[model samples]
Target: MKETKKKVVNIQEYKEKRKQKEVDRNELIALIKQIATLK
Candidate 1:
């Protein structure tokens, strides 16, 4: 039972990390679009 709880916590952490990465990637894309428009 303890192992299951630990696994759930780990999954939540992994999901949060992935969410942060997606946010970073979106910002990077937005910057690229702005630069492209300038060119």
Candidate 2:
């Protein structure tokens, strides 16, 4: 039972990390687009 709880916590952490990474990637893309347009 303890192991299952730990696994659930790990999964939550992994999901949060993935979400943050996606947001960062999107922001980077937007910045790139703006720079491209400026040039």
lDDT of all predictions? 1.00, 1.00
Candidate 1 structure, TM-score to reference: 0.84
lDDT of 2 by residue, 1-39 (tens): 999999999999999999999999999999999999999
User: Candidate 1, after superposition: displacement of residue 29 in Å?
Assistant: 0.3
TM-score of each: 0.84, 0.92
Give the per-residue lDDT of model 1 (tens digit) for 1-39.
Answer: 999999999999999999999999999999999999999
